[model samples]
Each structure stands twice: as structure tokens, then as C-alpha cells.
Target: MLAETDIKDRYTSTNKNFWFKNMPTCKDRQFGWESNNKSVLFVNHGKTTLVDSLLKHSGLLGNGPNVCVMDSNELEKERGMTILSKVTSFMYKGNRINIVDTPGHADFGGEVERILSMVDSVVLVTDATEGPMAQTKFVLTKALQRDLNPIVVLNKIDRPTSRPDEVDSELLDLFMGLDATDKQLDYPILYASAKQGWCTKSLADAQEYIKNPPSDSQMGSLLDTILEYVPHPESVGDLDSEPFRMLVTQIEPNSYLGKCYLGKIQSGRVRVGDQIKALKPESGSNNQEVSKITKILLKRGLLTEEIEEGIAGDIVLVSGLKSASINYTLCSPSVTEPLPFVAVDPPTVSMSFGVNDSPLAGREGTQLTSSLIRDRLLKEAETNVALNVVSGNSSESFEVRGRGELQLSILIETMRREGFELSVSPPRVLLHKDSEKNLVEEPVEEAVVDVDAEMAGIVIEKLTKRKGEMKKYLEVADKVRLVFEIPTRGLLGYISELKNDTRGTGALTHSFLRYEEYKGPIEKARKGPLVATGPVGTCTSYALNLIEPRGKLFIRPGEVVYPGMIVGEYNKDSNDLEVNPTKAKQLTNIRTVHKDERVQLTPVQPWTLEEAIAYVNPGEKIEKERRRF
Candidate 1:
């Protein structure tokens, strides 16, 4: 067993083969983010919780004789999910390792791709109980394409129903299905319980450990496996000689430090105050600006240590670069060879973000002007390589395009929290031209749904109506797993409907499979909406009681209402009906004989932003929303 405290505290090693031992001598080496030699990228499909958990379980989060860096983003902490790629480092077995934690959800796939270019290898984390999921396949395909060998970690193996052997087989099938190379297919697998903080290379050992849990070394096998399987940075890059070059993978703004460009050094060495040039290959101007590096920060543990110089194959944060964008190469002035830029996955969904033109427009937010909205969007586009922001014909509107509705919704939620009032149009799929210049509307995705066997019929019916082709169906432990290749446009509001149909027991996962020709005229028609009538007023239970029998209500009593605002779903027909929610009861002979005279109203189905965006298409057209706010 490895000494956890020694591995956690004394990370720096004088071993000649250790990467950190090769750091260049320079002035002002107060050791702030000083460059570390080894780096590994952690890629998962939402299997693990904290990126630092694997290391922290081994006593790596505290003031280590080795440095630690952990996820500090407020949004990530709040959501309990990684919204962006986070960089952290730790020392193990006389080696310094920089860990890049990438988002697991497909919505943030672009972040995973960008971070892969900076590291030599990846740790592919998968859930043992669920096996390789939709996102697991998606992310694994990316890693294989990048030619990065993977070290698979079968996480959550301590679950009562975990089938490690079955999951292991499924993973093999996935690798072969994705056409992985033989070397990649022969990947190493380890069993772990990230929550329990123990891992073992052998399944039998893991089972034994579960019976008598080890208290001393919680995650030694994982660290050892990583060190054994993941190659050293020297094997991936030319550390001996090359100009100082790095492809900026992320750009972050700091009030005190201005703009900081974070990436791994591609070649040579860069010292603080070293003159570096920023090159934009896509800008088409051959324009380059020479600037002096003011500060260099490196990954130590959970925090960054200031370093004077950074060598090749090390991830570092460099300050003094202005307007630094993703894929921009920061290199020595004499270095002309630019690194290959990572192609951004094109946007499939678009929504118009316009100024809040409702009756209560400026009442909720301060940043309501088009100029401020446009500036904020442009700033986001600079850092978020996956997003596209283009101005609409009208000054008040800007079209925001992204991978999916969830991605766009996250942006909207972030802006709204920042006091920005905006009316978002219904999401529309962006059309693309195929190889023959044929008009293509959207990409087709493979949606895999698992639900109670009894509820499978309704799910199939719903999906079939949405132009989905059922590919396979299987029964597993009283559950039915159905696979369908469905059009992306049809899935916009399908989540809410699926939950309703399955009584919240269904699980759905989808991934972009391929782009196909326009599937013309998918039937998206449904019943009409119950709209609010006339002028703005407050809703009352008296009116709600009368309307409860006709449809489902979205508004509660005393809530502010507006004309044309959809209050509920009209269950009767396709025609929209205006209802008087502000109507008061007649005073004469209106007293009820029963005590507790509160009007009994059916519980209203509250609509979230995603649900509201999906429900308001009046004509079933794949365009903007017709419901007025």
C-alpha cells in the first residue's frame, strides 16, 4: 500500500525521470502556478461528482507537500455539474500531474474537444450499473478520433445492482462499434467507487475490499494505473527544442488580472516577460500582435503557484494577452508554424434573443437595452467556442445558435441572473447543405429510452408520431429499453411529455448520430392554449375554478397576468380561447353554505423555462413562439 499522506504532501520529486525536475531556472520563481511536467485529462459521461474526488480521497485536497487545484466555478458548484473544463494539478509518486476535468454532458461536448488537444491521455470514467451510456459512446468516439489512448475506470461499482462484468463487456462492444484501433481496444479497466473512495484493478479484489473495506489507501490502484497506462508528456511533445507555442483552449476574465489565456505549452520554453505573438488563422488577416508576458501561473494542487518560466508539455495560465480567443496560437515571434485548430461542432439549434417587449419589460431587469445584450453575447462568443451570436434584421433581436436547447437555456438562465431582461423565441433547427447542396434541416439523433415495461407502448407511440424509426427493443428486469433514430427538431419539447407519459420513471438519452436530408412535415400539432383575456390583471381562484374543468392552468391566484399570455393548456380543440382570469364573483346570493369556502381548483402544472419554450407553438411551425409574454 502507498503512503497516502506522503503521496499527498511530498509531490515534488528529485527523481531524474520525474517531469517536474526538468523545470527551467528563472528569476522571480515564487512558485505561483509554476509549470508541472505531467498532465492528464479526465473525461466522463457524468459518472463522477467532484473532479478532485479521486485525488482528495487520497488526501490531495489539503495543503499537500504536493499542489492541488480544484473546480472553483460558482455555476458548477451550484448545479453540481461541470459547466466548463477545469484545470487542477497534484503530485503523485514523484510526478506532477495536471488534471483537466471536462464536462460529461453532450451539451458541453465542445469543451471536451478543446481540452483534449492539451493533454497526452484521458481517463474515461463510466458507471458500472448503467454500463456505457449515450454520452459514454459520444465522448469515447472523440477520444479515439484524437488518437488518445484511454484508461477506463468503471465507477460506482459499489452499487447494489452493479454488474461490472456486463459493463466491461458493454464497453468493449462500444469501442468496437466506434471502430477503435486495436491498441485503443486493449484498454486497461479499473473498478472504483468514487463516493466510497476505493479502487482496485481486479474485480475479486474490489469484492473483497467491499467486505472488509480498506481504511489506509483509498485510491492507490487508480493512481498507479494512471501512472502506468497514461504516457508521459515527453512522449507526446518535443521537450528538447521548439519555439514557445500554445493553442489557447480557454479565455477567462479577471478584474485584477484582465484576460488570462490558459493552455499547454506546445514547444520550447517561455519565461515571464518573454515576448509572445498572438496569431489568428481564421481571422484571414495574417494579423499578429507582439506582447510581453506579465505573469505565468501553474497548477500546484487546488490553487495556482506563480512561476517564472514554463516549458513544453505543461499547462499554464498566461496573462498580458488581450482579446485572446480559443484556438489562437500564442508563440514566439519567430515561430510561424501555427497549430491545427480544433473544428468547433456547428450549431444545430437557434433561438432569437430579443429585448423584452412585454408589458412588464423593464420592470424585472436593468440590462434590457440591445447594446448591452449584444455586448454580453459577443463576450460569451469569444470564450464559448460552441456558441454563435449573430445580429438579426431588427436592432432589438440577436440570433443565438448552439448545440441544443439545454445549452441555449443555460446561457439564458445565466443572463437572466445577471439582470438581463430578454424574450427568447422558440428554438428552431438550423438548416444545412449536404454534399450535393441539398437543403438539410437538422441532424438526426439516436434516442435511447428506458422505461417501465408497461409504459413502453405510449413511448413508442409518441416517438413514432415524431418521425422516429424504432431500431431495437429489449426487456431487462421489468424495464423496456427502446432505441429510435429521431429527428432533432422533434425532441425540443419531448422531455416534458416523456415524463408525463411515463409517470416520471422513464430515462431518455440522445446523441447526434448523423445529418440527413430534410424530413418534411413532421406532425407537431396538438391542442390550443388557454390565453389570458384583455388587459393585464391578477389571477383569482374564482376564475381558475371555472377554467379548471376545461384545461390545465399555469398561473396561480394573485399572480400578475397579461393579454395573450398562455395561462393553461386548452384540452378541447385546436382553437385558442381567451379566458377572463380577473373576473370576480357576483355578490348577491353568492355565499356558499359550506364552511372553508376556498374554491377547490385542480393543482396547476407549473411550467419551467424549457417547458414554456416548447409548449407555445401556435401553428406547429418550426419557428418563433406565437405566445406573447
Candidate 2:
């Protein structure tokens, strides 16, 4: 093993002043030090664009329409948002840098929490115009609590309305508000426009790059800052001599290689065919099993390349472990103690998933049996550590709990696309009992809303009626940012309403806070649902024309409807109203001149999976069909 002095000298003596005039060829640097830095790009503040630009500038991606490689899932592409944490790596100046792109939405906080354990530092991407958002605070808090080094990137500096100076100041204030330590307070900042594909260390340089078109990309400065600020794993100790140990952070099923577990090597080294033991520390010390490694893989660019051996500090994928799971430790047989694992926050919302029992159950989807649904849900729970599944009161239903409604909705959508049919109930906040106080507590969220100054009053009034308490309000130019502590259940279907109230210009985000004393009953602001209560038949334009005046219709003239199915939302009443949408106009022996006129029916509004889930109330279930509700 190298001495501590030698390790320190190795990094200090390397090419600290090297700058990339152009992309370098794939060759190892003569610096003898194996520098591998693992960093995570977190938050929704232009991380995807920055990641794509970095990969392109590194020559890992070719010039094109700037595809977001991290969001490879179909649903992610359709929604233009990330729902899962993805791993990718690139080589810069002969150093291997692993980057984990995590979900930015608060509902996927579980993904961000687990991946933080495997990364050494974080690149907290914040918007130049919006400054720190709700998700920005959520992820930054997690990174700070772990005492990880942070590098801030002020993205979208090229926007016409960008305010880098003010945003930078706000960022510093946020750090202080979060009680950051002296070391964390002193973070490095970079200015860039990821969409334009350039970044610089100083504001002047960024402005110059924006004014004068650079023949080559200027992302080298950001890469250099990362290598310098993020510490190498070897700096911890003589990790090469320690026993082989790795804590599984993520698990993915492979069609050809079975299950693949991805994690960072905490200590020692492991090679293909090496024998290892799987230890479940949370379950019990006696629950241990032996296994052999079949293949070792390392992420290169957007794909995984098989490697013969993996050393400490490197994130790798290992196969051939049949029973290994997340938070479990894979280590040398001689090592009995497992590495410490960070526990994620408990789920705040839950929904019921049951076998499709509607009349159209087996018409559209092929997988309709209860056993098939149960197996698929179990498989999902095995890899998704944040999600919990428990059997419901009957054999046909299961309660699925997660961080929030969006998270659960994404899972349901994924299952729907996979040819699985299931009924999903509206999301409900998971409540707890405070034993000492003998009081019931519900989950509360820290909500951040940005709306036009003119609409702020109505926004505040609406949220107040839902039991939301405003904690802080600030005016930014013509916009107002309001922070509130509100019950989780109060914000169930508020997104659509907020958009309507603000004319589609309002933005709102929230994150889990803590369980507090239950607030007294708050009246539901949502209107009643228009249920179709009649024999199964096709909808008629004559009947829908009359119902359009009562509320918005969800079905057109030719769509099929059945009893107990929600057809539309009632606008005037707050009680569930059953209407016969299948009723046809009585035929007349003699037709008047107006009777020959065509029926002028309003167009029906389609509901996405998330919208449908949010629109449902108690005792209402959204059926899974090829045609969305």
C-alpha cells in the first residue's frame, strides 16, 4: 500500500493547471495516480441539459438534437421529466468520472437519498432565473446533512431574463438558512447555459462566451473544477488492503444476466469468479448466504462495459447473486460486519391497487388475473426500496405506499404500459399516532408556489382554506414566491386548479416535511364527480349535450360507459350525481324544423394517468384500459 504522504503528493503533483484546448484522445495520463471521482447531478434545475452538454463536450455524445440520455424510459421521454436515477460515466483528462443523474421531483426523493450514499460529491444545479426551488432545497438539504462537498452550477445564464448575480446571492442565503458548516458554505460556483453548450468559471467569461460564438465548447472549466473540488476515494485510507465490502444501492433485472446490483466498492477489490457472501444486516446477522460473481460491469458513457476486476471507490455492477437486495452487503466471507446504510424517509402517501373488476377488465389488457398483478407488484418492490406493498383486506387488492402521489402514479403508468391491468384508488396521506401526546398526526409538506403578483391573493386564499399556513412570502420582480406548511392531503388535486387560477403561468412544488398534530377538518374544495349510473351502453350526443351544461364531460358521443364509472366532473354541486349518459332522446313522429339541426356537443377533455388519479375521490377507482380515462 502507498504511504499517506505519497498519496497526498500524487494528487498535488498532477496537472492542476491543464486546460483542454480541444477534446483529448482516449489515452491514459502518465500521472500514475488512479483518480476516480463519483459525483451526482441533482435537482430539476437544468440538470438534464447540463448533463447532455457535458457528455457532448466530453465526446461521449455526438452532435445532434441534444438528446437526454439519462431519461431513457419511455414515460420519461413522453413527459420530458426524469422519474428514475440513472448512472453514466465519462473520461476527462484521463480521469474516470462517474455521474449519477437523479430525479428532480420531490416524489422521487427516495431515489436521490439512496444514490447519495454512493457519490463523493454533488453538483447542485440551480436555475439562474428562479434561484433555489422547492426541489433544490430538498436535495441540497440531503447532501448537506451528509456533509458532502457541493459544486453549484448557475445554469441557463444565457436566458434573456437571467439574473445570475441575484440568484447567486440567494443561493448563499439558502446555505446559511440551512445551517451549512464553514466548509460547506464555501462552495464553488460555475455559470453556464447548458442549452447553448458552454460553461465558464467567471461571469465575465460566461458573458464573453455568449457574445462571441466559441468554435469549441467551453465546458472544460466545469470539468476541471469538479476534479479539483471532489476528493478521491483513496484519500480516506489504505482501502486496497481492507476486506472486500459493497453496499447495494440499486438493483436492476437483466434479461441475459439475471439480476444486476450496482454499488460503490467501500473497501478492497473483487474480480470475476470471486466468492462473496450476501449479508442482510437489517434482517439479522444469521441471514447470510454465499454467492459467486459471474460478471462485473462498469458504466461507460450510456452503456455498461464488462470489467475483469473492480477496485475500491469505483461504482460497478455485479451479477450472479440470486438473493441479494438493496441495503444488503456483498463482502468477503471473512468480513461479517456490514457497512452502515442510510435509511430513507418513510412513505407519506399510499394508494390501493387491485385487480381490474370492471366490465371492461379483460377486454383491453391481457394480464388481468390477481396472481399476475401480485407478482408484478412484488417484483417492483424488490428493486424499488422506497415503495412498500402490503396485502389489503381482500385477496384481490394491495396497498402500495410511496413518497407521494406522483411517485405512485408513475408506477401505475409503467405497469399499464406493460400490459398489466389494475384499479388504482385515490392517494391518501399515511397517518401516525404520537404516543406521548396520544394524538393522531398526518404528513405535512413544505410547499413552494410561484405565481404572478396579481394572482397571489387568490392562491393564498385557496391554500388557506385547505389548511395551509403561509410561512414566508417574497416578491421577485413581478412574481411572488410563497412558502407554506400544508397537510399532504390538502394538495391532492390542487395542481390543475392552480394552473386554471393563474392561467397556466403558476408553478408549484412541495416536499415532505414531518408528521405534525392533525389539523381539524378542512372542507374539500373539489366539486362532485358525474357518475354514469345506467346499463352498459354507448354514449349518445343527445344525452351528452344536456349534461355538458351541468359539468365537463369525459366521454364523447360514441364512447362506452357503465354504472359506477365516472363520466365527468360536476361543476355546480359538491355531491356525487349519477346521470344516464347512455340514455337516447325519445323518437318523435313529427320533427320540427329545429329538430333536424345537428346536436352541438362540447369536446371532451382527456385525462392523463396522473390527472385521472388526482381527480378521483374516496371510493372511486380509475380503471386501466388501452384508452386512458
lDDT of each: 0.71, 0.78
* Model 2 superposed RMSD (Cα): 6.5
lDDT of 1 by residue, 1-629 (tens): 33546543333433323333343321111101100000001222233342445556545454232211343666555555567777766556545566777765677778877777877677877767656656666677777898878888887777677888887887898889889999999899888776555788999998987788765447778777767767665432454466788899998777888998998876777888889999885654477878999988876656666667777767889998786688999999887767887686788888888877777677667787889989999999889988999987588889998888777877877787788888777888887777667566568887878788889999999999898999989764456778899998878788888878888778777777888888886776668788889678888788888988888887889877778777888899988888989877765455643432578777766556666677767322121122212
Query: Which candidate achieves the best TM-score against the true structure?
Result: 2
Candidate 1, residue 297: CA error in Å? Answer: 1.4
Q: Which stretches of candidate 1 lie over 4 Å from their true place?
A: 1-46, 62-72, 234-241, 435-441, 476-478, 586-597, 618-629
Across residues 15-116, which tens digit of lDDT does each residue of candidate 2 receive?
311211111211211111000011111123567767888788877777788667778899888777777888877667666677888887878888888888
- Could you estimate the TM-score for every candidate? 0.88, 0.90
Candidate 2, superposed: residue stretches over 4 Å from native: 1-44, 234-240, 586-596
Error of 1 at 511 (Å): 1.1
Q: Give the root-mean-square deviation of each candidate in angstroms.
A: 6.1, 6.5
